[model samples]
Target chain A: MQAGTQKSVLIIDDEEDFAHTLAERLSLRNLAVQVACSGAEGLAFMEQNLPDALLLDMRMPAMSGIEVLRTVRQKYGMLPVLIITGHCSQEDHDRAQELGVQGYHSKPLDFKELFEQLVEVLHQK
Target chain B: MTDKHFMAKNLASSTHELQNILAIIKESSCLVEDVLQINGKPRMKHGDKLYHSLEVIGEQVDRAKVLLRALNSFAHAVSDGAQTCDLVETGKQTAQLVERFVRLKEHALQVVVENGSAHIACPPEEVIEALHSLIIQAITACTPKAPVLLRLGAQQNGQALAIIEVAGAAWNPEEMEQLAAKAGGSVVLAPGVCTVQFPCAASL
Candidate 1:
């Protein structure tokens, strides 16, 4: 936990229910959670309310999660980013690894494990 | 790749979509469970029942995930026209694909690997189809309580063999030559057996 206030997390995922539901769950832990339903929207949100960490979904139309990651890396290099994907190929996984993402997970995610990883990443800041 | 690439691609896409759907359901279920545990315990009246039911949902989700993964894997066989694959694993996957059908018939399916692992070079989908056809035949011929055994191993001359044994089997192996040839393999007919054998040392 941070010193005084709740740590904030920004979730970038096109899946509306998945993003909001997860955000609501994390909010119960006393953290501020925001959801962006698209890569563009997430980037736009980050321009002002840069959260402590990011939960990114890999597959999206127009601008993909990897594209968003690339932009974030260039703009906010040290921010912790965890990838949550429905179906990612080996090539994409390797690319994410090369880009030095904090973590990667598949769909029908283990919420407990995801929360633990999120906490660990937040504490590192 | 085979002509089935389009179909496989569609299946792969559908599995991903369904996976996302499952994820949302799982998270929504967890959210409900979380609310019920606000006081570090469940609701006063139906908390325990709700928790148990949630557990059942979780287990079913896990089960459905396995089937989805298998379907996705089966779709992936179209990635190449020819490749080397573990025969034992292929048999197990084939068995899983036909599980519901076997259960409806009250038949058992088992994969038994002998001595060592068996590797075969061929279009994996073709082998699966061949094995699938054999299993159907085995189910029809075997005794009600008998199992359909998918046995895989290496031949004496470094060849690989996979056989499905049926009780009271009577299908002539010659009937499967055209089918087996599609997999670069052959069939051996016996009193209660149908074996598909391939030359491991060679590749087409």
Candidate 2:
């Protein structure tokens, strides 16, 4: 993906408001954005469609981000996955890093830095 | 784990959800700002005030998020059965949890934490509960509008202590000593300072 070119990003977070807001922000930045409110929904969406990059949350009720990441990696290898979480333990962080997450960030997010990473991740793809 | 443990877990999890709500509010407000900026700020009437209001909302959301995060961390402080914990972080969490309550009574609670960890091995929840109670008592005893200070530090004997200072208030050393003793600690109240020295890890 070329820099400044339109890219599609999927944000998987259980918080509807956060996902919508992030989607709006990404869209404003000129990137196509899709939001899934749960890990299961995100996985279901990924089964049929692959975005340029993914933004995933760490903690969820039924299915966790780690579980989603594991499944995504096995099913769709090398797709850029960025872990965005508000509550994450160091153990989870190390595990996600080992799982080949492109980047990791904590909330409240730094949208500027997140956008730059999104662009970079899309470029990598 | 006891019922208290279950309650702490619930509180921590709730904070996570609360944070998401705050994030959404912040983002929605940001979207409004984005629209205002894209439409050209100078062209719209009352655009400046509207933008300023959005900014204020955003600031409050950010502030709420920080408090929620601190509360969340504090809730999880009890996750582990008695273990070593940083006194500074514990003091901050204790203050954050009850800040609103203090403010409701028209008083301020200022928590000042040192950089280094003053590690203490004990039931963090119990210690926090005891210290929090002592602070509240001290705050009640203090004059109106006086700020209560919760300061954490390491003692000469490598023990951890939380100093709850209430300006212009006289504390009952004997009562505070009893409170601290119940939590496996000791207290020294002088004029306006209530020092709570936690039990050593070895004792625990």
Candidate topping lDDT: 1
Tell me, by TM-score, which candidate is best: 2
Which candidate has the highest DockQ of all? Answer: 1
DockQ of every predicted complex = 0.65, 0.54
lDDT of 1 at B114: 78
Cα-based lDDT for every prediction: 0.81, 0.80
Cα lDDT, model 1, residue A86: 78
lDDT of 2 by residue, A9-33 (tens): 9999988778888898788778889
Query: Measured with DockQ on alpha carbons, how good is candidate 2?
Result: 0.54
Would you estimate the TM-scores of all the predictions?
0.76, 0.80
Q: For model 1, how does the per-residue alpha-carbon lDDT over B140-186 read when each residue is reduced to its tens digit?
A: 75677677777877464656788878687668565577677887778
How close to the true structure is residue B16 of candidate 1, measured as C-alpha lDDT?
83
What stretches of model 1 exceed 4 Å from their correct place? A1-7, A49-52, A120-125, B1-3, B40-48, B76-92, B108-121, B147-172, B175-178, B185-204
Give the per-residue Cα lDDT of candidate 2 at A61.
Answer: 84
How well is each residue in B1-204 modelled by candidate 2, as lDDT tens digits? Answer: 789789888998888778767777777888888877776776668767887899899888878877887778767766545465667777777787778879987888887774466666756676777777787788776888888888886565756788888887767777778777766778876888888887556545
Q: Which lDDT value does model 2 have at A90? A: 57
